[model samples]
Target chain A: MEDNQKKYTELANRIYDLDGAVYECVGSSLGRTFTGGRERTVRTLSMLMYTKPDGHLLRSELALISNMARTIKNKEEKSRMMTEYNEILMEIEKLPDVFGKVDILDDERVRLNLAAKREKLSENDHLVICISRTQGSAGNDIGFELADNLKINYYDVEIFDQVMKRLEADKDAVNDAENFVDFNKYTKKSGGSLKTRFREFNRYHGLPKQDAVFFNMSDLICNLAKTEDCIIMGRCADMILKNNHIPHISLFISAPFSVRVEHIMAVRNMNLKQAVRFLKKMDRQHRKYYQFYTGEKWGKPENYDLCINSANYGIKETIDVIRRMIGK
Target chain B: MEDNQKKYTELANRIYDLDGAVYECVGSSLGRTFTGGRERTVRTLSMLMYTKPDGHLLRSELALISNMARTIKNKEEKSRMMTEYNEILMEIEKLPDVFGKVDILDDERVRLNLAAKREKLSENDHLVICISRTQGSAGNDIGFELADNLKINYYDVEIFDQVMKRLEADKDAVNDAENFVDFNKYTKKSGGSLKTRFREFNRYHGLPKQDAVFFNMSDLICNLAKTEDCIIMGRCADMILKNNHIPHISLFISAPFSVRVEHIMAVRNMNLKQAVRFLKKMDRQHRKYYQFYTGEKWGKPENYDLCINSANYGIKETIDVIRRMIGK
Candidate 1:
């Protein structure tokens, strides 16, 4: 039911249009020249200046602001923006930054680098490919096709040893997160030890590990985001590729169940139907993995740069379509 | 990849065809046939006479007898036929001899008194039905459709529990016959065991239970071949259904793997292409399972009464064609 990549590109263009609107909002807010903190002086006179196509703050949204601020070409204005954020913190009734030690400017700069890495701005960022497969579906074949075309690395996810290593590192975190009773009661981002562990586990174990040879692949991905673009297969890559400016494209490829069944029978040598039932389970696992980590619902248009149906477009055409869109 | 019921009928009609072709051989054999060890003599002779289309014993083979017999139609001249089996031994042999010396004819005559069962038969010694399926080709749907059309019992094979009990009781015999070795070989067929105990733990823990349910379902379907004229879905039904004179019309329904994929995707709500891989594994399991149980290669035209490609013949027309064939 997803629109093709051509449609997806049109949608992406609209999203970029929204970005222009957001920039305009910021301009309108700054034009007011209201910049103090006392009496809860606004960071921007009105958020109405920025039209959030989707309203509500995102998880870890200060990162987005930092990314946007980093793109500001003027060095003085970038530093000034950070100072303005610090001033907003002081104006809020909550508390005063007595020492001015938060260093919001440096934090934004760090976020800028992360966005750069996520976008693969330089040459060294290797593609991180993720894949979600059904029992009878020729997932490996498709992943191979895309990787061959893209000339990037590829891997199947069944190697449990590497997955476990990723799992072990985060076990304590996930257990802690689950065990944590009070989430949101502290400002230090405490609790969610289990969630953290699981997320890390999914990032590695859930991922095909060839790209994971890098230590701390997630961080590396964030770092790599600034270095170069990635062509990741399913494994929640859209979620991993979260930055608006990361220059990475997200894709979800699928075919009709019957077509999958026939292909399984012919190419994969499956029985008449074992794959049909399996597809349901895999779909659940895939969507949960994506939604759980990325906090972006899987298969949603907003989550992917392109969601393709190979049934409609055929495999080769689907990949080509994706290439064209990613190029854009 | 297969022809229709005409091939089966052609194979059946061959008995008549060869009956005429071998007239000279029959006359010569009968003329010189010796009285001593006549049962052995006839047994040896009959093996050389009737060769089915693909050179295996016919599924319709009731007795391993030559197209030409040594008997004369006239009772007075029948004394000459005494060179072969005695009448008493012949009568006993022709009856169900597997159990040894039971009043087989009288037993059948007695069972005929069961009104609910025998009432439907019109001078018919036996009733048989055949339904064939392809990998992910909606054979279950077709099986159910045929049953509904005929107003007969339709078994989905998945929910039937008695199959497991039969498998348990019948496991040793099956193992002996085919060198069968299931990986989960030791789980108790009759009752509770460690595996079952662990399963109970899962129920207590509220784990979704479909996995266990399906495994047991396949076990139940293993023994469903005892009844005649029933449509069974992919659980070694074709293998178990083998019997001579029962007209067990083996059919293989095929469709392009892509078509099967679509049917599954639309019916099951799968994403575009995810089901392709899974359909492959399931088909292999069914084929292996069939070969393991019956020692007959699955999907061989010789193994089937009729094999139709559903893609070539649409579902409705396919069903109609099968029905017409059965009506004859």
Candidate 2:
């Protein structure tokens, strides 16, 4: 019994170590900072291992660890590990569950449910254009020109201002959202108890401020769609509008990596490497944000009515093409 | 010494097993067939282990093995293997070389050298357009119309016919290329000595018929560019022309995955799932072929002067956008 306890503890320690490595790898790959949530999750799983926690929860956590292992750079070792991993899974499956059940906490479900409850507008009743673009793709320039060409209101940063105004009624929420952004940007190492760290991680990952901002922004977008014909840039407006069954033409503007890199270099006065790095970071952020909010793949053509490589048609012609697309 | 030999053999066997797994994974992932060259490579490395082979050669071979390991789906296993993999690298680096030096064989080098030797037409001396596209993106229709609008010769499968005619002079080469394609399409298993198997793998992976066809098609593309303004579709004409330093406008056409699937469904009468699968296979083939030949990422904006989601502008507007970009 003592030997078995030691063996399980060793397994838990290995899981903890692997989870950290994966968290760091995924964070660096996405150009984001690693936070405390993953570690907390790992600790929870580690503790629950003794009690024979829910198999599904255990499998899901282990699956994440496995994903990181696949990134291993050596073949012979990888295969050996894979074989061992298969054995571990078999062992896990055989372990009888005797403890209290642990339910998976999915905050995204709440957001999705809220989205599903939105009042959908008739297809032709609203004219909204949502432009999602990669950085330096001239998406903003094109979106502005498109709105001008069609004589419609254009919402970009103004949407943020509107959301902030709405959040002003709850000053603490606004302050928390602002602080969260600041924390994400500047906080490298966080200090707290494991429980507090886990809560902080959940607050950032699952949302409190970010979620509040997103939900409020979503409401503003739907309201605008009902009130007037307009063009909304970023903010996952395309998805928010879609959630409401509002008639909107979604456009994804992208240019080749090199072209966009060049554009960034020219506009931002950054060198090639810096521009590339900046673009990758921005692209990742947009993708993550979109995926997080909408549960849809961003920049995928089926999601959008029209997708354009804006570099193919210069800014003016890109606008012209959109105008023609809308038959204006 | 006997123990060392046994240990090396064990390492070799592990490499062989892992290499087979990787080859199968990559082939299935790309929807291609696994050829024999990889096994031969593994055997050579195994044999060389006793003699102390070139560190670079051994490393490169191991690198391929390592790449396969990255595909392992289990995280704990992946991490464990990766750690062991790093240790193996340290061990390999510590080994003393004591045998004849082996040089890496790269057939792509010869192709690249041949490309370098081609005569470059001055910019503005040639007005050539190359269009590369995803399956079911209406790239062909756009290319045909763009050619008609420009009053230029449009080459599509005609390039294949022309290449076939060129290869006819070398009937055996033509027969080999044709037979190779048939073999790739139909042959499930091959039985041969390791040497012959390796050679067959090299022939397919590196080139003989496919390479010959590619080179001839390249020559034709360059020659045509030098003589007249024309639009070339597929056939890596863009890269071929670029390699020759011939002036040309390259365009990549794409539509959203769902949109393309619908297009294929309507055009080919395939159901949604079938169309999706078909599109994915075709896209993978084109990507593999393009990468194999050009050594550049396919559908990257930097490679092409313009890329359009044809679904955005439709056939006519898409053509118009291209025509306007060229100041037609």
Candidate 3:
């Protein structure tokens, strides 16, 4: 990937160098105002008269000169400037090459072609899109919206429902296992005294049932992949598809902690303490679940084709960006 | 998480309702300009005189009235406008309240306080920072920069070196094992027919030696964590620390694929194809390695305290943002 960028960068740099030389020939550097007074004015006037004023430059120079001419109070000075401009114009009329330097246009075209080639080479495989997101990042919302816009099937609880329907797995048992594992971690971190009763229940129950449910869910995910192009949220879908050699675009959506907490606080009507605790607990469970089943970090950027911050970009813009990325 | 966000949305709606009423008292709707003509002007003038103008409102109103006066065509009309403005000014002078509405300021203060509170709540376990990054996201660069800025001890391959020096493990064999695991998956996905020779070599040689190396490295990581606050890069340090109940901030850094590819291409002096291939292989190995031992997603955002895009924000800004986030 790095090597690819280098070639493009090298091409870009070369284009800039060639273009810069051409720019110097016609006067004025790219991205800078024409500041060299009389010399710049003369060169610009000559270029305008000689070259087919590539619309942008022509419009700018015409505006500048007309504005500058308007500011001149002395008719004699204005007439002198007009004479210089006309002299340059007459000389330009005699020139063979109408475009001051053709190299810049050629260079720009080459640069664009190189960029296009690089883009083409980096296009992604798009059989499926597996979206794994943090709890409060609005990953599910983005997934549903993306699936709707892309007109692909979306599977969130449907994946769990499908597995449950097919395998007769107890949903409550799975939830208990997931909650227990996360709760156990939190309790262990917090010294376990406050959650003794829950700990006692979890200690006897364990996560074996959850493990069975997860394994079956993995198979169900693979089966779904074999059948359709869909947007699957969570459930370690990205990992499952990758392991099975299924082509997919994996997406991870996240937001900064403060934004997420605020989101929770507003949505749950919880105080700061409650919102913080809820966010931490939910995130812990998600991490544990992904780690347990896929042995991969749930929110790792590399695991996904796109990593978006819903809070940073907002849902609509993020979705639009994703659509453009997917070429949909 | 969705439940939590819903409550916050409810509270925000309530705040808007309350604020809207207060805004109506002030004779203008929030976030909208008064588009009504003479009646609006009279009401605004009356409000400016009768009610106290908050500094923000005073500034805005002064600017708006000054701009409005500039548009008067006739000298007599302008004089009349000035007289009316002077009357309002005189009335404002007699009034005791300089600012009628204080809700906006109070609202702003509440927002700041809420933000501060959230920041305080998210203050992390800072015993160690285990940074997991993508192959060409400049994760190591950011890690080194972060460690230097925070004045913490930094570890990248120092852990591997420490483990290797202690165990005398065959480094080449370990590399071969890592390469093999990554290559194995790729070939498996590609149908395994063409790369059979490489697979045969990897299958027999296996990763036992590397596994030994990894185990020793995990012990080294824990021992180091027991001693000091340091930033450790890669080698699934985040996972090991988490399981051991060591308090740490795990960070995942990544960039878009094209950006990473360009980085690798330039840094490694490889062509686009070579860079792309290299990145894929390296990433696969990193993922496999992290999952193999830690059983966690290598780049999952949930696994980290913060996840940044070096390409999106740029490395310097990303580092600064992380530093601010960590309060270092």
Clashes of each: 72, 6, 32
Q: Write the per-residue lDDT of candidate 3 for residues B168-271, one digit (tens) a residue.
A: 44444334333334434334552445466465447445544445456667787888777766778777776777667665666678865777887766555578
Model 1 vs. true fold: TM: 0.26
Candidate 1 lDDT, A1-328, residue by residue in tens: 1333333233333333333433444553222221233222222222211222111121012223333444456667656664554343333212221111111111222232222233343464444444443333334445555654564433333211223233555433233212111222333543347776466557766742223432243444455345433344344543554443343443445444565555544442346766565556566655555554566655432232223344333444435444443332
> Pick by lDDT: which candidate is best?
2
> In terms of lDDT, which candidate is stronger, 1 or 3?
3
Q: Write the per-residue lDDT of candidate 2 for residues B1-328, one digit (tens) a residue.
A: 7866666666665555555655454442421112346556446655666553232234434543443455556766555544555565555444444211211112232222211112443444656788888878778767765765664666665334434554466434443223322333223542446787567557655664556656766776788788867777787887787678666667778776766776676655578999888888778767777787888877765455455666554666667656655556
Q: Which window of ten consecutive residues has the lowest lDDT sum in model 1 chain B?
A: B97-106
DockQ, each predicted model: 0.01, 0.03, 0.03
CA RMSD (A), model 1: 32.9
* Among all candidates shown, the one with the greatest TM-score: 2
Query: Tens digits of per-residue lDDT for model 3 on A214-233?
Result: 66677777876776557787
After superposing candidate 3 on the true structure, give the runs of residues whose Cα lies further than 4 Å from its correct spot: A1-328, B1-20, B26-126, B167-207
Question: Each candidate's iRMS in angstroms?
Answer: 29.4, 25.5, 20.9
Return the top candidate by DockQ.
Answer: 2
Runs in model 1 deviating more than 4 A are A1-328, B1-126, B130-132, B162-229, B243-247
Candidate 2 TM-score for chain A: 0.54
